[model samples]
Target: MKKRTAAAAMFTVAILATAAYAAHPGADYIKENGYKGPETCEECHPGKAKAFLDTVHWKHASKVTNVDGLDPKKEYGMQNRIYVMCNGNDIVNNLKEIPKNPETGKTKFSGCNTCHPGDHLNDVGSKGAEAEKAIDCLVCHSTAYDFRKRKPMKDDKGRVVMGQDRSKEAALAIGKPTAKNCMVCHEAAGGGVIVKRGFSFTKETDAHAAKGMVCVDCHKAKDHKIPTGTDPNNWANDGVRLSCADVSCHGASPHKDADLNRHTAKVACQTCHIPRTGGAFAKDFTVWAQNPDKFYEPTTLKLEANESSPVYAWYNGTVANTPHFIGPKGSKKDGKSKIYPFKIFQGKAFYNKKTGELLSMDFAPPMANGNTRAGVESAARTLGMKNPEQVAKEAVPGWQTIYFASSHLVTKTRALSCANCHAPNGVLNFKELGYSDKEVVKLTSPELFFNKVAAKMKEDW
Candidate 1:
């Protein structure tokens, strides 16, 4: 009788543990039978699959509702967007021209596709049921995600396309996304590790990361739609701004001192928190001039370190998304504007002399044959511009600037002191920020300004 009771207790404990494991997102639903495609997930979570299809994660585009100058009714994202990187061309845009691997006889997916979750080579070919089947659900959900398993696979129509890990372990390892899930793509963006976003989840850099808080703690996704702040180059989470001052976070008045809290109204949290970006290898400047040796490579590539100074600017949330011009929408005079930190990146691209628009070239093709001119013409043709060769001929190298908000790599302990911006030899250019000489002098003189606020405040400083 004693032995039977002990056996029963052990069985109950094992059953309870199994139930607890099933509580994770999609864990219970996804059977541990085998590694099927998104169709396997759709069998149980049809609505989830359908909802995810419309999200920016899958489409890589969203309605242009946030950008200041863009038509709100139209859609914008990686498919149609341009940036200072890669000669202004979005990744996988020119799939028709991308050459097939001689050995495989299969057109290998572009390097950018590694981070992307879709099975299709490019967005153009992915459509309808095919698109649904292409969604790699494991990439976001599975803790055991094996990115190395991503390789060429046959689609429904027997066409070979890029596919992600379909391992049984990945299928069974489904759960809510952790920081590792988000960082897998975010960390390795722009061709290399820790190159693009400069978001290395470490205690030394970020307070939130120090506490083992995941990105979703702040990003706060609702039905797979993650929220991010104002960024002209990124259209993913437009209009959905996440900030440290959110009521759930530090709130309106985070500081103990009333005088310091007043600055919160005019200064963004990131202004002091995120001192710099372009960590280690982020390309600060690139010139897309033709290279004789490597036709695909940029003429000049200048990388910046983690301590690189950010470009200070005034921001009222809205950013211009005009193809030819992109920047923040506010000046110092704007009542709603707050002082913000930005990473100002510059690149040289082929400018159309007649239309004043920059031409996006398909440099991927030229990599195979060492033909820069052909790459330019191929890109011009893809744009459907008249006289592709003529457009390439008339194109001239010109400078383009892109401003990205420095909102990550936050360090409360290492936050800038008041003297860093208020001293005589301060980092900020007061005149450039629209302050008059008199106002600048008064602002710069921290001692004189703090004296009138409170005697204790001056002593504390």
Candidate 2:
């Protein structure tokens, strides 16, 4: 009795599942019409159908017009002029038919329409039309179209009107179009086929692709209007404005001025943000090799200082590994002393041993005249330092401040030292450490702490 009950329950569940699937209109449509082709859709959407006939996809699917100075029927032994590699049953032998140009009298096999199917056919079923016009939205968008359930108009007596239901069957009906469906043809050797204006037939295989993001997600109709170029006016639809810094898929902004979020006005996001074969590129900005692990955060920083005191600063970061800095230097006390030693002036200044001059200093106000307040006024002036300071604060907000005591004291010389700015971990941790990492890696000896730190940064950081 128990076994019989279990079998009955399983049978009931199967029937319910079948009924649920049958309810979906798409499934019913596919059942009735396998794939009738674009002609069925033309009956309803004539305008769209007309536009589709002008595309390249329709031309590829059509029968060969001429062959070898003769008709396709005379040239090829096949009954039909178009000899497609049929996946269906009835594999006819030697059915391959070569296409020819009627005007040039030259024989051609297959063209662009072989892959882009939309451009091969015409609305009127004519062969003279250009192939590019066949790329109809229905070929890709109409996943299913059912005419069986379509109801006829009702009369005043609530009876179905005769000849009112003019529902036509669809062609190539099946599952809905998805990102996976697009990839079938768009993908090429190792990656998606990139086309004019930075468009790709397939989605990128970077981290975003791995996460299952589709091409249409970011490159929506609105976003596609912007073409890749220096001149913004050339862009279609007056250009698409998007925040490259805010794209969640890419994670973070790669620009120094990313925090300002002012990129939308000057250039489209794809101009600098899109992935290229070599790397990312911008007009006058530096480019980086393809890096899949780059990360960014939207943040800001504030710097304040006094004449004798170090500058205080803070940041609000989203992720870990945020960078920080400390004091600067003035004059050297000993002959063999390192310019920016950890201790010495309690981490206040980094001195130069040769000329007994300060190499770097922490953030401090310039010495003010007696008329102005000494510490307070000088601190205010230092706080207002623009350009590099403002740029840095915007790039990485709340980042620790390493103030150079006085601009006049140090020689404004920039050194490529790992320990200087990066310290124990240093910029070596960066996937691409610019030229500074390469230079530092070569100069230091193997046993030196700086060398170990650089190696460790490369390994751990």
Which run of 10 residues does model 1 get worst, by summed lDDT? 280-289
Per-residue lDDT of candidate 2, residues 1-461 (tens digit): 99999999999999977874754334455446643334444434455444443322322122222112223332121111211111010111111122232333343221112233332222222333342233333334433433232223334764332111122333333223455445444432111132111223322324344456544454343211321111111111212333324454333544454422343332223322221222011110011122222211111111111112212111111111112222322222222211221110111111222232212111111111111112222222333533423232222112122222111111112222334334434422222322355655553324435565676689986
Q: What TM-score does candidate 1 reach? A: 0.84
lDDT of 2 at 67: 17
Error of 2 at 144 (Å): 13
Reference-based TM-score of each model: 0.84, 0.30
Candidate 2 steric clashes: 48
Cα deviation in Å at residue 259, candidate 1?
1.9
Compute the lDDT of residue 427 as modeled in candidate 1. 78
lDDT of 1 at 150: 69
Which tens-of-lDDT digit does each residue in 246-288 have in candidate 1? 8998999998877678988888888888877764322322233
Q: Determine which window of 10 residues in candidate 2 has minimal summed lDDT.
A: 279-288
